[model samples]
Target: MISVTEAKQIIRANIRALPSSLVNLADAGNSVLAENIYAAVDIPAFDQSNVDGYAIRFSEKDITLDIDGEITAGSEIIKSLSKKKAIRIFTGAPAPEGADTIVMQENTAAANNTLTINDPALSKGMNLRPRGTDIRKDELALEEGTLLTPAAIGYLAAVGSAKVNIYRPPALTLIITGNELAQPGLPLRTGQVYDSGSFALKSALQLHGIRSPEILHCQDDPHELTLALRHALSESDMVILTGGVSVGEYDFVSQAAENCGVTKLFHRVKQRPGKPLYFGMKDDKPIFGLPGNPSSILTCMYVYVSLALNMYLHKKESLYQPAILKNAYRKTAGLTHFMKGMYNAGYVEILTGQESYRMSSFAKSNCLVILPETETEFKPGYQTQVHLL
Candidate 1:
């Protein structure tokens, strides 16, 4: 009976960020950092060359110098450059002691252990990467609460972080409840339909970078549903029940949750497609009883469950933004409508097959356009709220 915004607030108020754990940098991708990361050592660790060149103490233009020693990448040669002497160096190699300049190989010409600067524009420190230039030792590398992306991981590695403290993503259990549901790729018996909810929900989770969730199937019976709910709640930090949430005779998800000692936060929101969405909690675990319909489950997941999971990880939640409606839409229902929409170039168009059970339009859509409950008519070029997928 609550508005969508109020329902979201209630759901978030009960959630808390998960505990931090040490994870190898290799496995930290897409996880949020729980601690600030400081550079343990300067990047590059020492003065380095940025090009294949000769390292020499600059003095005068057009001066010939004697070749001292060669230093390639990862070499430990530490020969110092004397007056009018140069050391051959390759990219990433440490600059030899007493060397202050580098002239590109093309800018110098060598003849029989002697080198002459050919370019008049050669300057001191032109091709050198100074020590600690990229990052200083003990500097802040990444802030706390940063999302560990691939580039972030590489930066952490560059700063000598082998492991990091990150907030772990929640483990999930999916209880698919229905007797008439049949697995896909199998022949359907009488009064049976393919079980697309499980596949669709799994894909949705994967799309959001969540790992595969534990899946369980249950019939519509009350006792069986109650047992499945209990087991799922014990196994996961979050449980998603995909059916039997409504008040029909066979609907048992709500009753089962109550029987398992779950506190019902809310039963339904004033929204179409997913009006029967149910939310509850047992101990600290959050449980969602999503409507059985394909579009309804997906819509509720994106709107509510996604936010709950992000809150649990202490990550920033997604917010709605305005977009131009490309076409007109009219609705007489008093409930708020979340229409499947195709969005591009800051414009959105409502797609067909918006009924709760149908996912044809949902498959092609990239956003959901919100229509407020008070007003129902939308015209071309109308600005409305949009939640991008």
Candidate 2:
């Protein structure tokens, strides 16, 4: 058995990042950039008007001027202005050839063909958006490895990027093994329980941007488990198996992994809820054998599987932050405890039902309060490490 930190380090060292691919700009949200993006042309390529008023040369102030031709947004019409003359322009319209300033319509009074500045605070170049002000041509727009946010997507679209190179999300295969498991909506037989692990794992994976994952079920027989494991290893970049990892007679995950030529990095960890967690690798593909208990499987996914996927996508790993405990709790000084917790207004409260088999309390929680293995007792109001869900 190894500590939690050591197990995570071993998994990280064994896995490799996925390759990059060109994705359509419309579908690039939440993806990491594989290459730096440079501006092909200046944003607002031409001098633009920011208000629906007048574009003047700004040689003189506080004077009436003749109204030149009007320019609406997206119009290709270009006109030059003479001295003491202004052009009627709408927002986003290109400035006239000789205009260098804009006075907003709210700040000026217009009559028939003449305009006068009504506000005394009007200055030269006021309300005018110069060309290349937002971004210059051939300049770096977005650097490599930047996570594409909604605003980032809009900016890319504005710069005419139809497609971008990004690290693709890894395809996964989830193999659920246990003879005592039955699917939901089915009547349970003697010594059988509903399979909540698959549902919970699938929902949790979807939340992390994995829309579709191949899932397979198998009985406790070693031959059946080995076949399923081999097939999944061939199909996916990573494989996650639930149940059959302990040392019981029905447990066969370790044997199946060995039969499939996977090197076991670690078999157990000094952690509560998921102490029987197994991590292995076949070449560059990782295999995670998680415990069958509902809360245990979910906890292991959040702590281990999520980290591996983040690394493959070149995303920043999750961090632990300090939160004030609302109550006191006690545990033996052997294994690290990941208690279901609700975080609100900078304080975290450990919820009830901390057992591996119960998931109701976890469903109501938004974080996991991490208690180190060396601490046996916790007092109220003590600062503790928390990982937000």
Candidate 3:
């Protein structure tokens, strides 16, 4: 068994990033950029009106002017304003040639073919979006390693980028190993339990921009589990096995993985709920054999698994957020405890249930409070570390 820090270090040292791929903007969801993006063309492309009103030369604002034909958004034609004239224009319509300002329709009165400027406070360039004002052509838009958020994707689209280069997330396969597990919504036989790890693991993977990883289920038989491991290694860049990693007589994940030619990096970690976690590698691919308990699998995913995935994308993030303890807590010595807890702005309170099989408190908690193995006594107002869910 190894400490949590050592487990993380070993996992990181064994994995490497997958190659970057050019993906369509539509498919890029909160992914990290592999390359710097530059604006392909000026935003707005032309001076355009931001309001529904009139486009006019600023010098002509003080006098009544004749209204020319209107300009609507997406129109291919541009009209030039004659001296002492204004053109009716709507939002997103290009400013007519020889025009420098837009007057809001709400601020002016118009009748017949002429217009009258209303109350003051109008200035030059008012309501007019200048060409290239948002981003000039060929300017750096987003740097490499930036997260492709919704706004970032929209901004890239504005600059005419249909696709981008992003460090690829792995193709993952999940191998569920158990004979006593029954699918949800089905009648359970005696000594059987409903499987929760599959749903929890899939949802957590989705949060990292990974969707719909292939799932394979097998019984505890040695041959069947080995075949599952072999198939997962063949089809996926990473494999996660839930259940059957412990020393139980029925547990066969470790043996099956070894039979499938997977080199074991470590078999246990010195943490609560997930102590029997197994990590291994085959060639360049990484494999994780997580404890069967619902809470343990999720916690291991957040800590050990996240480190490996981020390393595969050339990304780094802090693992803990500091908070002040709201209540004193005590625990047995010799094992580090990752207790489910509630975290607010700057404070945290450990909840009641911390058992591996119980998820009631896990459901209510937003973080995993870290209690060191050496420190057994915690007092209120003491500084603590938490991993936010």
Candidate 4:
């Protein structure tokens, strides 16, 4: 068995990013940019209006100007402002030619076909957005390592970027092994349990922007498990096996992985709820043998698998953050304990029902509070670390 830190280090050192692909901006959210995005055209291609108001020359503010015409949003014909005249303009409309200022409609009074400025706070270029104000042509809109969030995608779209190159999410395979498992809707026999590891893992994967990972179910037989492992390595970038990793009579993951030519990096970790964690590699593909318990697998997913995903995007980040303990707790020494907890306003509180087989507390938890392997007692207000879910 190895420590949690060693397991994480081994997983990190082995992961490599997937290749980049050119995808439309509409579908590029949550992906890392592979190349710098340069603006092809100015964001506001021409002089634009920021509000629904009138466009006029700064010198004609005090004079009663005649309203020649109106300019709604997206008007392409550039009309020059006549001397001592104003043009009605709406938000996002292009500013009229030779207009140096704009006055909000509320600041002016219109009687007959003329307009009179009623406010003294108006200034030059008050509500007019200059051409290229947001972004200039050929300017670097986004850096290569930037993550494409919702606002980032919107910004790129505003700059007229139809497509962008980004690191694609890896293809994954999840293998579930156990003969005592049954589907959720089926009536279970005496010793059968619902097959929830696949569902929980699939949902968790989707939260990381990985969609539709192939899921396979295999029995405890050695040949079947070995063949399943081989198939997963052949078709997927990463493979995850839940169950059949311990030293029980039915356990077969370690040997099966070895038979399929996988290099074992570690067999266990000194962590509670998931002490039987397994990690290995076949070529560059990573394989994780998580414990079958719901809470244990979920904990491993947050601690170890999420880091491997960050490596897939070449992102250097850690989700663990420091917080203050809200209550006291006690445990035995020699193994690290990860308890389901709620973190709020820099304070973390451990929830109830933390057993490996029970998921009630895990369902209500927003984070996992980390208790070190050497420490057996915890006091309130003590500094601790938490991995956000």
Per-model TM against the reference: 0.95, 0.94, 0.97, 0.98
**Candidate 2, 97-166: lDDT as tens digits:** 8788898888878898998887677778888888999999889999999999999999998877899999
* TM-score for candidate 3: 0.97
Spell out the clash pairs found in candidate 3.
Answer: none
* TM-score of model 1 vs. true structure: 0.95
Per-residue alpha-carbon lDDT of candidate 4 for residues 175-223, written as tens digits (9 for 90 to 100): 9999999999999999999988788888988867788998889999889
Candidate 1's displacement at residue 165, Å, is: 0.8
Q: State which candidate, 2 or 3, has the greater TM-score.
A: 3
What value of lDDT does candidate 4 attain over all alpha carbons?
A: 0.91
The digit string of per-residue lDDT tens for model 3 on 263-377 reads 9999988889799999999999999999999999989998888888887776675358999999999988877889899999999999998888887898899999999987889
lDDT for each candidate structure: 0.88, 0.90, 0.91, 0.91
Worst 10 residues of 1 by lDDT: 203-212
Mark the regions of model 1 whose C-alpha exceeds 4 Å error after superposition.
207-209
Order by lDDT, highest first = 4, 3, 2, 1
lDDT of 3: 0.91
Candidate 1: tens digits of C-alpha lDDT, residues 200-257: 8898787455678899999989999898888888888899999898889999988999
